[model samples]
Target: MSDSIDSPIIIDLPYEEGGKKYDEDIFARALQTETHQKTGQVESSNVTEYHLRILLHYPAVYVIHAEESHSQRSEPEYCVYVGETNDISQRTYEHLYNDPQNRDDWRLFNNHGNMSQYVITHPYFNKSLTLDIENQLMLYMSSVDHVSLPVNKRVNPQRDYYTHDRFKRIFSDIWLDLHRKNPSLFPAEGIILDSALFKASPFHKLSDEQLEAENIILSEIFAALHLESPDQIATDKTNPADSHLILVQGAAGTGKTVLLSHLFYRLLTQTLPEEDAPLIHSPASAWKSDDKHQDGDHASQRNLIPKEDISAYILVNHDEQIHVYNQIATKLGLQNRSGTVVLKPTEFLNRHSRKNDRHRALLNEPIDKADVLLVDEAHLLLTQGNRAYSGKSQLFDLLNRAKVVVAVFDPNQILQSSQRLSPKIQKLLSPADDSAANPSNNGNDDEPSRIQLDDYNNAKPLTVDVSHIRLQQQFRIDASPEVIAWLDAFTDEGIIGELPADCHEHAWHADDSVDTRSKPYDIRVFDSPVDLFDAIKKKAEIKADGCDGKGLSRLLATYDWEYTSKHKNANDPSGHWNVELHQDGTGTWRMGLGGGDGTDNTSHDRCFCQPWNYQLTDPHSHRKGLNKDQAWAEKPYTINEVGSTYTIQGFDLNYAGVIIGPSVQYQDGKVMFHPENSKNKNATNSRKDLGDFAEENLKDELNVLLKRGVHGLYLFAVNPQLQQRLMDVYEASKND
Candidate 1:
């Protein structure tokens, strides 16, 4: 409680070689006062006294950073460590001298020869607030393009505290002030907030459900990995095929990916006491946690004697999503002397399994097993043989190469025949049977149930264990329960019921809300594709006031148009495949190719037309835009192109203009889905094993397309009946 609260303080100090011993000089300067006192008299004022006491006793957060990439021909990569402590001098001393002896990150910061640290403080600093601040710093640094590695790995997001309401403004203020000091190190806050990596960062504040799921995952991992000490157990001799699976079930935008990312970071932060190697058995004598290594204590000194590094891998199937994961893994230093840590399932399988397994597993040689494998978008994992993979099941193949496999599965997101979950597997994943034979899977995720698999080669009786945890909240849509329910009904069950009264209400901007400045979540239906795209661009334009604009809007559609990958269309010589709609409200369905110049007849006004994904020339061909690695949707020029489930599946947009193609239509009393209308073979094709899944596949594609918008979803249906129905619903809701 100073007389007036001042802004956060930021000062960068050099860690010089052969300099004076470290001291608390930053706070010492803050404590300096121009008090005119007699030689023996001591000054006393409540304001000064209060400031002095808090400065001496209160908590503060700090960041230490040094260049990691030292190549003369390349750019500098800063390795950053974020932390909070009550005693700055003691903590810095511990990190500088003692911590370097244990952790490699600390050693680099200590011996890099050129190092600088930023010590931050504020009048409102407390244990909780400082810890949250430190976590937020980690979240941002993990996504910053220039920061190559994050030294801090622990998750310390706190619940509501005394000053919880001020956290966002305070953190942004601190970051902005710091940005003024160093632009490269601390870029614009808005730019960072708009990144995919930032949205999926591990340091974010988890919902109660996410936090609960994280705790459950961690406990399961500990229980599985802590079965015995490293030396006592025969891990090398044990079979890797007996690995367990933790299946997290949730629909799209339900925060499944965030929970998975948190688990991935947390699992890597753990350590098993393995002088020889890691073990799955519990031995109390040697087991210890390396979670708090950033607490500035050498492992040995603090009895955290972890000799073996925990083997962990995070895999994904989607290209865009895997890109995001690899960036995060690289920035968090989530790797070792071995190759990459984040990889595709095929890469993981190919690397760990014997090459003969594409034909057969190498005889006698053991599988190169990892301690844990975390799979995101597991629904996309192929179940049958393909060109790159010859396995029976990717999930089973993953289990064969690791001690544990944790998968995030959403049966609804399965968009291909190859990835289709068979009836048997679906039954195993989300058990609908509550019989005595499968009582454990009675809709309870507290304990995992067992799944029997016909052994890899039918050589032995092998069964894999499976667990199911459900996440029900929709995190992507910034709307109320009624709004979300309407979306779910419209997409999931295909029931175009009356829109909710508050379907357009902004949940964050209610009269009784904390942040009432955000714009409402827009839900509209447009008659013209041109109008829909125009509205999306209108929303995409940067707003002057509080619309929470990230300046990204995209036009998406159902898989109805023919789009060949990388093939230049001969009809339209622009070298781009276009999704065309003529001025008469007719689309590719009527014209027999959306882009045939509308040559059939009538006037070709080109009402609405845009290139499909990967067809546009490089918008950042001159140089890397923003000097950072970006996903397909993050690029500035992608706005001109239409995205599909492949490029934009695991991303978010400010607003989405989705054109419901001929695949989805409405009739007298119900909605109809036409599989034959869609050109996406992945959705419309049939499998030799599982006959016809076209209906569900197309539905899932529409589901993903409609849910991409965070603040809004505008629609234009190619089918007239569907279009009229949607418009009628909008008009009815408006007049009411």
Candidate 2:
């Protein structure tokens, strides 16, 4: 054949002619046939040049074409729909079997369903490509259907109803109904609606009447439930008359904190005196009000009310969260001797001194008069201890006394076995009782029953009986419609959308040495602790350079090292890392404070140590010399603080490098195989037992280490075996 003839001829065939010539058989054969180039599949007769262009440019697109013949006496036997998908097989299954969400469309073609034929075009063949293909396919199909209408004819009323705006409005209405009637069925406590569905709906622009109606309806709903309106709950307002416990649940970035702040403001300002009166009735009075104490001075002096009048807003969490909140409060001028009280369980206990028994007794008295109690991380508050002595009753007692309490919880981040509470708590927070325990239970009566509140005889229960509200809007990023849709799909499908659009451009430049230029999204992984140490040193260097060698402020180095303790041979080389010392050799590790004299004579052992002067080794003691006692052994194991990841959770740093020591592993489908295990296995055997003793330690280690970074995270697993385990977790989480 001539070169000109060999080149496939491009034709602008009519839809009918194209359909007749390229049936299912021809299309299938073409897809399977070997092409001349051996790289590309043979061109199918059913696919058009337009579709081919789309496929070639956008490898994620799938093109489907069909034709049907209509008899004058009956309806058409076939209807075609074009769509793209990451998984062709799944999309095909849904269209052919699983009815599309819009039942009206399905009903229109139900009579001719048997005559329908389906063809799928695969974009990518990798396992990861499945979801992407399916998503793209859905988008393409919807888009094609949108533009396929006859231009000259009047628009279909049904089509108008399915418009992006209309879809969003309908979905919003459905969500509102579901949220009102069956609130607990939705995840994230229904605070998160389908962003895509919302965009497709027509409810975004509420008319003045609609807005007023919505507010009134919402107010009535809250009123009927004897709960504060969502607006009132979010604003910083206090209802001295109504003592109801409010549960505000939602994912991050849903204005929870902002709403809480507003509520605080309302609570603070609403109680101001209505008017200020002068001491004297008139100017003619010879003896006027004490002019020395002018209104301006009075106003200035009385700007802040007495601590007793202010509602006690308590934010509870583990030690770390409390520490972070304290720091934030201090910076925001919200902290005062009585206005803000920061207390850990140990700190609360320590306040009871043996010498000041009377003060200690008063300190432990019930907080029955507290006006308001806000628990920021309520999930962390529920965790139990091994014994009653270490239990959280102190915190529980305080919570029970408050007139109003607000809490936030994320079920997915449950960190401890004890943290998991009874269904009673879940029921109280959930909007409805149906499916509150398990939506997948199929209403099985034979299933094990839940423990009733009455079962706990010794303890007085803390009941949160008020109505619930869920915040659905996310204001974290300025995302495009496409990006929002993609995120929504990921959340719906239970897939981890790594490199989400918010973090898309967060990579660091390979040549950029300055830490200031580094992005937060960069994934930094190292095989050894030395590498992590080097990364930290680099950041320190950048800080030093930025400060013109004046030395960085608030920069500290903390490690799991014991030689740095205050009680250790003060003469030992690494004795500057400890924060406190008791008569015993044990001491606490100070997370911040390092850099000191080369001889290590600093009063505060935890003072900052220069990088060049610091050494990761123990030196032989001289006077009162190296105590050979096992407790005082100068061995490496005794020198470093082992497994202290919990000390730094809920904290942020300019940069952080986590070094995964060798004493960790994953074996026999369980995370174990550690030397510590061999010595501690006798402690417990049950999953809960092991989890209580080990899992929290490991998770705390990871959580604290991960959270330390404000701009960057550098992870280094010292052991290759442990590195692999960490990698497996990262990969598995990504897949999820």
Name the candidate that leads on TM-score. Answer: 1
Q: Could you say which candidate leads in lDDT?
A: 1
| Residue 185 C-alpha lDDT in model 2 | 25
Where model 2 places Cα greater than 4 Å from the true spot, the runs are 1-266, 269-310, 317-367, 382-395, 410-459, 466-520, 540-572, 576-647, 662-693, 707-710, 724-736
Off by over 4 Å in 1: 1-6, 17-56, 67-76, 101-103, 226-241, 272-309, 336-339, 357-366, 432-447, 455-461, 503-518, 543-550, 585-606, 624-629
Q: In angstroms, how far off is 426's CA in candidate 1?
A: 1.7
Model 1, residue 568: distance off in Å is 1.6
**Positional deviation of residue 69's Cα in model 1 after best superposition, in angstroms:** 7.3
> Local error of candidate 2 at 514, Å?
18
lDDT on C-alpha atoms for all candidate structures: 0.70, 0.34
Which pairs of residues clash in candidate 1, taking residues 3 or more apart in a chain or in different chains?
A: 227-281, 227-282, 228-281, 228-282, 356-360, 357-360
